[model samples]
Target: MSFEVDIGYASARGPREDNEDFAAVVRPAPHDEARGLIAAVADGVSSGGQGRLAAQTTVMSLVQDFHGVPETWDTTVALDRLISAQNAWLAGHNRRRSGEGTAMCTLTALVLRGHSYTLAHVGDTRAWLLRGGECIQLSQDHSFDHPDLRHALSRAIGLDDHVRVDYSQGELHRGDVFVLTTDGVHGVLRRRELAARAREGSAQAASEALVEAALKAGSRDNATALVIRVAGLAAGRLEDLLLRGRQLPVPPKLRVGDLLDGYVITAMLADNGVHRLYQARSVATQALVAIKALHEARASDPQERAMLAHEAWLGSRVARDGQAGLVRVHELEDPSAFYVVYDWHSGQTLEQLIEDGRRLDVSEVVDAGRAVLKPLGRLHRQGVIHRDIKPANLHRGDDGQWRLLDLGVAVSGREPEAARSLHAGTPSYINPEQWQPDDPVRADAGSDLYALGVTLYQALTGRLPYGEIEPYQLARFRRDPRAPSQVRPDVPIWLDHVLLKAVARDPKLRFETAEEFALALERGASRPLPAHGSTPLVARDPAVLWKIALVVSLLFNALLIVWLLFLPR
Candidate 1:
């Protein structure tokens, strides 16, 4: 696939001094494997002694040293190597200025190879993806705190002798858009708007639009934007060509080893209370793979067996099209074992990316919505409901495509479809209808739709539609949620209304299905929603505040009184 990229960057000495010390560089790599594209963004630490020098030098040196990356190695390994190399360069640079260096800036670098991407970052600068009408953040801030910080970064390229650089890998698909920006651009634009703008015309235009939006929103620092769009894929399938005729359950455990068919188990990648994911390899070609299995305890329980079967069933259905966005599952040979096998993927989960506290641009959030909803739409069409859709379950693959995991089995018990009860899923991300005990486990795409809304809201605004509520409190979501934009003014008004509708307390008021909800979100970026539309319960009534306060006070008083009465008397 021939790749096309466009970048727009602007810096304003906004409301401040002359040194708009931020600097960025976009260069093509020399290696054929890399398809050779590299971009870096640096924000000079306004307070640090040598902020400008640190940023400029770091970005420039990174671009120069990038050619040294081994073309034979995987992108993940290469990214780690680059971060180490750059940090080392900065360390020596910092030492030379030792007593003189006062300012410290952050660095974020991106490397594109064929369709894959490797990202490394520091501070709050961000990287995002716009694919299938959604905007998805691809990097995390190394900041020490959330919202904003009054202090310098906890770690910068030159601040420490050795910096623990966190990085991840992802694949880029045709129409996939990537953005890199300083806090100046992100702090003001939000992810939904960024994603939407990225889609408007070219990457260059998107970059310009982002900087203008940030400036308009009152950015106090120098602002910059680097936009890269994956215009087309090379003529062949990247993964398919890399590993062919691979078998499952490689030499290791079913989900852990490479013995199942041709797939080889690399390592256990992730585990929650219910399932364990394994990073595996292809036995035939030694390709990296990801395998997912149910927890042993859940698999052992007779009640959970059916749920496990249902989960595998749904995985098979979704992967029937062999969409890279959805994980591949194997049919159980014994049907008695407690695990399912899946293709391994390398990338950050949405939860990991959001921990940086940076919100995604509007276009990025919408791209994410589409990535999730496209497969979800396929699942719904086939009568499958991914009861749980959250950052944790959504996987951004090495190919840059988004994949959904742990389908059908929100809780470990039975076929979610046949059950007439609301049983599983995480509270913050679960849909409103999922709270109805009488609701059937089947065709609740509305529930999934609500989850999609919550995911999009969190991605773009950096806040949940209902804020943070306890699991038991989810039952109260029977009412609509507050608009996301209201919670965070920078959130585009269109997104605020769309998310609220998706998570509408009443399923009737919510998007009827994943498809319907996705359409609204996809188009909502370009067109704002009507302000007079239905409002969510979260914003409509603070009456619950009084009730909640009374309850909290009562609990506190009760506890205090009990303590006093129990005292020696």
Candidate 2:
């Protein structure tokens, strides 16, 4: 499958002394086709002193910055962040040149990713979709209501410190046409007239015709038109993704001195039943790295292969912008086998550190929690949930940084439908609700917090809070486990309360977000601690209270029966 498009644009100064409109279409390289094509148009505020610069910079920045974002990010997320940053830069520039006047502009952008189109708009510039011989407006004009002030924009880039961009998305099909225009063009031409011109000629000719029509219709402002016609679309099927994974054969029982691609295997790190990990060195750079590949026994399984590919995809998206601890995945150059290569780091697994009797001070624990939660927070913001977060999956580098790892069971907002019975995460660390049959509440950021709480508890005291739970056994969370302070005397009372709240059995009782959990941990020393045994037994351990009630009732009934029998004639 392939995604091919035809793009055309035309700009006119019209009756204005200077043209303040800009537009562009960005085409990705062969390797970046998955990121898709982008079309953007910006119209500068005519009254502003730097109108032309504003329009040019807005369009050019979007085209360049959008592609720089991580491929794993959803189209909406990537666009939102890029636009917000651009707005900040424009606003700051205007402030720096106080007397020079503001740099303000209206923007509309369209992204064709996979099988859908994402539209982002601000101010009066408009976006439209022409299909089935009908033209439909896809953007809302941010202008005032009063007739005298109708031309005044209520929202535009560089107008404020922060801008609210309108966003929408819909599925795409072949032959769909996307149109963008500044107010100068759209305000002058009627919808029907614009549609007629768009359907009359090629995309380039149609764009030029639209601009000419606006100018002839007495448009006093600069006019610009951009047209995009979808020539073809790739299937974007699961098989297409699997084919990429299958480009190279699975490595067969790698050993020391073995060579794959340009990397030479130096030592085997781990060989779990499902996958193998090796420490290798690059032949060209002589840099040490880690290579992970699926086990030969599971290589043929579609599910396992899909998970491995997804792990690589998810990792690539979140490792940018000073996000430390996560090792970036390197793209292979014509590899002969299927595997993932990661930048090697000299680090020790959290599990190994705990087993080696390395004690962490409260300050260190707080810092670690903050480090891990930062990336988790980023994932949640992107509509992703890390289902598996445990000691073995966290690495603490010698540089005093902690990074979360292993997104094998991660769930994204765009995840495909799967069976509800599929197991997720390790049983021992999984939230109690996750173990319930047909559980309605799916694993989320809160669930990740529960697992993190367990890890923290284990690190402080070399024991599981509720004991290890077997996979098939019923997970009973009705008993209140010993608090962290009780298990480890050095643990502060306030810190223990924070951990208890994090691991609460009911989802509602736990922290609602990673940020809240991290804040609680950071401020543990300053906050007031709850009184010992403050939680009601019924709330903490309902099952135990119910048993005691039953035993008491039975004893009272027996005594009453005996008293009546002895007194009766």
Candidate 3:
């Protein structure tokens, strides 16, 4: 069963002249069923003369227009946008007819897509979830607590030009039950009573019993109730949640025995001053996973947290697209702290191999280059630039496959400013263009190729092309590096040419795409690339003119001495 559910709802005017309450469940055509089911209930504010219109229009717009929203939108974003638009229209209409009743209502909307549920709430409308024998309130009532203001709502649709709707989301289970109700039904009935009624029979019976019970309790207002019971959940796309505020709290620095969302930390992987890595194993499946979290000191910084969030999103995106060169990002379903999970692969990084004095021959260098560049090419095609691609960030798994690591600084265009604006990358491996005076931190395909070239060069010759560059230092690319063959005599001629072209001082001279550079390596000496000649002496040696001038003067003086000694003086 794919996302099967049972929905039932009931509404009545009770003692009022007519019901100003609305309840609906919208399911799209079978072909477009991935939009999922939308269940909502609204209570019109009596003070707003157009309360009925507000309640009806708000819920109707969402159910009717939701499927038409762009497919790229996350479920929460789509619902929030639709709700906000309806509020604006109601507010504008009220202003145009100032002497009449305003259109305002309290709303609670629920969207069940894939294996999760997203909610939008305002005013006193409520959403409840019954799971594991506990009935939990999923939405807060946006009303005042004072006796006189008890019925007064602090927030409602069309109450103001700007409406702040509370949005929430969580994992859905097979036997979970969800209920939506207007204030009329909830004000008179307690959670125990509601749960008891909701569990007595089928969803239809539960919905009818809640409304009838509320009315029998002497409620003066209209009563409404909508109930949904999940029978199954469907696997779906990764739904993105905005991490602006109310994100999970950052966990404190943990110990070996520490656990997060059922993952037990077995050992600490690394502890940079800003981020911490831990090796953990899932208690349920016993599968190993690596956890990345903000250091306790940096947990307070929002920018760092956003960067980590973006990294996780990017990693998941890459993994979902079936890019084998990246470590798989695992979803926690629900988590206790703000941390990222990745498949833990026991491996040594290329940097580690080099540090152990292991030198890679031409064949190994080519293999590594192709391994890193193939998926890198795919990532670039997807408009993502792996900003940091040094040897340390390239791990060679025990299975002998190389995987790119650390997308914390990747520029994916969809990421926040902190992920893109931050000048990030290993200085030694960064391309010359990234250090430009006019557009420093600029990155593109060529820059990635340049970094790959540097890594391959270092792996082949055990030395950086332009030598070691410290971070934050302005790197000069005026000097050309010696060919890889100069440092390692066994370096092949074809690879030497490719390295020089990849790390060329001018960006224009380097390979423009991973495919082009890859072709050069693939062809090898059989189809060696044409040499572009050496850098002009003036560019390679800025003091060449001065040296020439000094030499000329010395020669002229020596000739004068010889003439004076040989001829009459």
Candidate 4:
């Protein structure tokens, strides 16, 4: 949970009129540190006459905009987007100011995040690393080695509209040191000489020493160095941890007495052929926990492994980032095999409550609903869609707190390709739009909210508003979902209006945001909304309407015949 790092940067104009070299270390606030520590160095292409502006712009944009991207975006994707935009702007600016020399620079950026480091380079200002007393060059210069072409760069920012950037990544370790330098510094000092200075003292001191050494060595160009020392290794990406676990060979079927790491399996929670959930207790602390592992038969399946890995990351983030309303995912200490651990709460699923015929009243259902809305809103804003939202995926603790569960089928925009294609939410809870062949927006925040409405309606009425749909059936959403009050007479009219709007057949008719739905719930009867959940008699039940019409017609004809026959004409 600790993010320990040291960063320092130094720059000098040297013998030049302006210091075109720029170096910066952007250490975000503690809450934003998860995006990692960023250090960037840029050496301006001085021959172009606008190097200073280009260098400053390149590094400054990254420092300001990196964490502004959605957290669900992959690290590579986020960096690529920011760099690409900046490059395009600089390229366009060069055209507009044709007389002004083109703004161009060589960039090298480093991101130390989680337990790994991502490096992006273009016409490199060089990057080097020192670990365990060994120094290694981490980047290759884009300039030619031939003396005539040495001054010409094959690639650089603002050189052209399109730029091909080289990206690389590797595991990070404590005590690892990263050094970024412009040509003026590395061009004169030997690799070992540069490493010697970087190893001297603190990050700032080392950076200063590198620049001073470069100047002392008689380099004419502007010089700069950025040093980053890893004081501690943070948690690795969830995907990396799960991949390592996947490679460890799944442990055999565990019994009640089986011990994994320090936790002992206490009971089999559920076995659904694909996965096995078990209740486990920590031997040291005697704390209860839940473990989800692949079925032995599915040990070699790659798709399943990806799904479980993504689920772990998604659920873990949602629980950790928010105040409450979700079950927390726990990290095990050097587990023996692939599995996900969750902090177990003593509770029964909402599915169990409904199955037990414990019908929820208007107030109880509202409270249960408010508990889910907050977390649901958080997930949507984080760029995650919980495709599967149902009573079975909701848990109510003995302490009376409701928690949303099971993100196995959720989409976080970074899921594996195979996982992305699989539509795996429960059939009964799936919104009607996902079944439409023409509907473009299949499953999204609106879909989740629709499913939630169905769940609360079921909780109150003990029946699905649209009835239980079987898997693979082309759901003919020929009619709108029934109102809650219609199914359960005791349900209030205001409750009926809210739940109906949530499960409306036309997705646009449904609540646009979780906040909106929650507002209606909180307002209760005080500010009841009146839109449409009301369908015409014919659409609701055509056959029943026809039957009543036929009966009325027969009775009217009988009365006509009796009056004609009995009266003296």
- Which candidate number has the best lDDT? 4
Query: Predictions ranked by TM-score, top down?
Result: 3, 4, 2, 1
Q: After superposition, how far is residue 454 of candidate 1 from its true place, in Å?
A: 1.1
Q: lDDT per residue, candidate 2, 198-288, as tens digits?
A: 7667899989999999999999999999999988874342223344565546789888999988889999999888999999999999999
Least accurate stretch of 10 residues (summed lDDT) in model 3?
237-246
Tell me how candidate 2 scores on lDDT: 0.81
For candidate 4, the TM-score is 0.64
Each prediction's TM-score versus the true structure: 0.45, 0.58, 0.81, 0.64
Per residue, candidate 3 scores C-alpha lDDT tens digits across 187-290 of: 89999998988876889999999999999998888999999998876544334323421266777888898778898899998998999999999999999999
Model 2 RMSD, rounded to 1 decimal: 15.4
Deviation of model 4 at 382, angstroms: 6.1
Q: Lowest summed-lDDT stretch of 10 residues in model 4?
A: 471-480
Global lDDT of each candidate: 0.65, 0.81, 0.83, 0.84
Cα lDDT of model 4 by residue, 1-569, tens digit: 57798887888999999889887888857776678888888988845578889999999998778878898887788889999999999999989987867889999999888767889999959999999889988999998788999968999998889888889877677789999999999989998899999988899999999999999999899989999998875555765555554665666789999999888999998989899999999999899999999898988888888888888877767788446888888755346687888988998899998888786667888999998998899899998999989998889999999888999888988888787788768888887656644553457899899899989988888878778787544444556766767777888888888988888776667899999999999998899989564666565444767889899999999999998999777
Task: Count residue pairs with overlapping backbones in model 1.
Answer: 63
Measured over all alpha carbons after superposition, the RMSD of each candidate to the real structure, in angstroms, is 28.2, 15.4, 5.0, 7.7
* Arranged by lDDT, best first: 4, 3, 2, 1
